[model samples]
Target: MNLVKLSELLEVSRSAVTQSVRRLIKKDLVSFEFAQDNEKKYI
Candidate 1:
């Protein structure tokens, strides 16, 4: 989910979601990719 949607879903702040996502990325539990149009998708 996008940051805004994720924050709302988790009832957390945007920064918190950002931090958590960063950690998950570092841990290789999640990954992100940017499309040719510059849209980000998480996998």
Candidate 2:
């Protein structure tokens, strides 16, 4: 999910989601990609 949507869904601040996503990416625990529609998708 996008940062803003994720933050809203998780009821957290955007910065918090940003930090957690950064960590997850660094650890390779989560991944994201742009679909054919050019929208971000998480996997």
Candidate 3:
């Protein structure tokens, strides 16, 4: 899922999801792929 959608579904701020995703990405728990539009998608 993407950060914006995840945030909306979770009823949280986009910044919160962004921070969490960043941590997970750094820890190698989640993988992020970028689309042409420069959105991050988690896998």
* Per-model TM against the reference: 0.73, 0.69, 0.73
Q: Give the residue spans of candidate 3 off by over 4 A.
A: 36-43
Off by over 4 Å in 1: 35-43
Tens-digit per-residue lDDT, 1-43, candidate 3? 7778899999999999989888988999998777777666755
What count of clashes does model 1 give?
A: 0
Predicted structure with the largest lDDT when compared to the true one: 3
Instruction: Judge candidate 1 against the unseen true structure and give its global Cα lDDT, from 0 to 1.
Output: 0.80
Cα deviation of 19, candidate 3, in Å = 0.4
Ranking by lDDT: 3, 2, 1
Q: Model 3 has how many clashing residue pairs? A: 0
Local lDDT at 14 for model 1: 84
Task: Kindly report which residue stretches of model 2 are placed more than 4 angstroms away from their true locations once superposed.
Answer: 35-43
**What clash count does candidate 2 reach?**
0
List, residue by residue over 1-43, the lDDT tens digit for candidate 2: 6777899999999899988998999999988776676676544
